[model samples]
Target: MTARDNRLHAFRPDLADARLEGEVSAERFVAGRPARVAAPVADVRRAPRPDAGLNTQLLCGDDVLVFDEAEGFAWLQAERDGYVGYVSAADLAPRAADPTHVVTAPRSFVYPGPDMKLPRVRALSLGSRVTVTGEAETRGTRYGLLPSGEAMVLQHLAPIGTVAEDFVSVAERLIDTPYLWGGSSAFGIDCSGLVQLSMHMAGRDVLRDSDMQAGALGTPLDPGPDHSALRRGDLVFWKGHVAIMTDAANMIHANGHTMTVAREGLREAIARIGYLYGGPTGFRRP
Candidate 1:
């Protein structure tokens, strides 16, 4: 076997890091088979608090790769994106998606049956991998893919590859989801809350609040006016507000006015605001 095969066949290391300070939430390991995050009120340490109740709040496909049930924290090295924080053992689930899952955009959904009329059961998130179980009638609107080798109809794109794409995919779902200060649930989310939630869903551990988030991302790219080269997922900082860059020219944020997640033109929004901290200190992948 080659190096890749050797790595996969090599003896497994301990993943004590993946364990958190709580009870097992879901099912446990079945030996030879991969492990699953225990379901219940398990504490996901060093993890971004998604909504509160805290039982493995946000789940991510990325978590599986670095998930070392035998270690303290699973370290996932991104091929493109950088590194993220750790996730407790209870938050992750089995990699049900087969390598064959497909999507239309970064984030998408799948139906239980080929018939659109059939009630859709499970909703697959971004970066989910699965097999093409069966083909559905080309409705020209909905798509289909197999999840974990199981047949299913899909409507939208099943995001695959790259941590950056996965983060962006999860971010889009919050669009128009509504904004709330200190809110972290699907019901409501604030600016930093948006970033924190999005990152958390993508398997990163980032804190809430603009200042804290600013410190967490990295150094500010610029120190003064000149917010021109802002990339997608970049943090747009202000006096009391912060937003996630949806694109180079647009951003999505939860503000007091909109009180929900909404899109804004980057330059237009920046120009409209009086104070602009164009200088981004740094960039944080997680």
Candidate 2:
């Protein structure tokens, strides 16, 4: 395997040759069963405890393959990106039989009934999938029925296959969202999370980390001395960070430096990131 394939395979053991046998081997994991995130947001941890380091997160309706359960945690693999970690067993449920819609808005609320006056059940973030059981209109507002019997505003959802016209525009909508390590939700997100979420909304599948994204995703741009050659929608990569150019002169990214999704001058970002995290390794266009 090439270095890039090696990196992808390392995190996604299920993609490796089934003949390879080991503790992480997928072939020996026939007992694994499918599940779905039952909560609005579920934290996947490095270990099975609240204090354990967070490895990633799953939004409501995200699919997971449960391998084992111990105490109150389930050791599972996130179906979207093949991420493996432990999540609260209570945060998962049997996969919905017919998920037809996905959350398109940055965030949306689920209520106990069709009435807006009903108590809120929970908040779901963008990309959350849901099985619509029925539809109702209350006070002129349309609501979709969830598998759990709750109701959510239909305006916040789109058919499962809907895709945005521009990935950059989707990212731009997340400006000012707080930065969170290993976060992929609108509530908190990281550099690659911003890219991955935006790309996913645009009907593109992308890896979950900066280095993985740098190795995959798009065609490399011709080498340039600075940001002078970059254009709108170009992906710029540094040693451990990534950003999306909004225009020839400006770029948007979620960076620890700013601790939020922010837009800055591309030339100035190149200079600042170069001094701080070393210059960008390269650029690519999708």
Candidate 3:
């Protein structure tokens, strides 16, 4: 049998998703159970341990297929991008949540009630999905209510099918966000995570990692030696890194160099990144 990417396939030595029964070897196979993320943000880890590496994050209302629940963790696959990993069981509920709206602001506050002065229930990250059961008016501020009885500022949400005019602007909206390895929200984000989140806001869904992105994202572009051919919304890639061009000469990225999402000169980036990771591997335009 051919080796498969477990991040996209659900299988393990002891058990596997029954859907892959004939294709992979495992001691047992069971169908994945439906679930939804109930937490504001869920860390999907490479292993079940809290200290294990985080492979990705899931926003509230994201649907998942849970294969196993053990030791306070649940092994599952994100339905959005098919990335598989372990999420804390506490962050998930057994029902598949249906979403009517998505958080459009960099972050949104879930309130105990419809009032802005009410104590905050939680801070939901951008891309967090919610079902707007109804609307409420509190002190002239409008709010969207959820089935669980929480409320979010109605202005911070957009209807489920709403699309952004520009994905690049969506990326720009997250400038100065903290850089985190596997984070996907406005609270913190990585390079590819930024790309994935911004693109999703524009109604385009891409794969999660840099290499996976480079392999399948967009058409190739020429950097013109001086790297002037790059334009806004174009993606430049290195061995394990990626960035978004904001203009012919400038680009914005969530980088370890600055520890925050910041803009940098393209020439400066090419030279700085060349020292440690070498020059740009390729460029693409979506």
Of the candidates shown, which would achieve the greatest TM-score relative to the real structure?
Answer: 3
* Alpha-carbon deviation at 254 in model 2, angstroms: 1.0
Clash count per candidate: 46, 0, 0
TM-score winner between candidates 1 and 3: 3
Worst 10 residues of 3 by lDDT: 1-10
The lDDT of each candidate is: 0.49, 0.83, 0.91
lDDT of 1 by residue, 1-286 (tens): 2222211221223321223212223333222324333221123333334343321123233323443344444323212122223445455555554344333333343455555555665554433345564555655544454543323445453444324446666777778776655555455566776676567546575654566666557556642345566677777777667777776678778777666678888667766665444433344333
TM for candidate 1 is: 0.48
Model 2, 85-196: lDDT tens digits are 8899999999758579999999889999887899898889888888888999999999998766889999999999999999999999999999998889988998999999
Worst 10 residues of 1 by lDDT: 3-12
lDDT of 2: 0.83
Cα lDDT of model 3 by residue, 1-286, tens digit: 1247888899999999999999999999999899999999999999999999988899888899999999999999999998899999999986744799999999999998898898897899989889989999988899999987889999999999898989889999999999999989899999999999999999998889888888889999997877777789999999999999999999999999999989999889989999999989999998
Q: Report the backbone clash tally of model 3.
A: 0
TM-score of each: 0.48, 0.89, 0.97
RMSD of candidate 2 to the truth, in angstroms, is 3.2
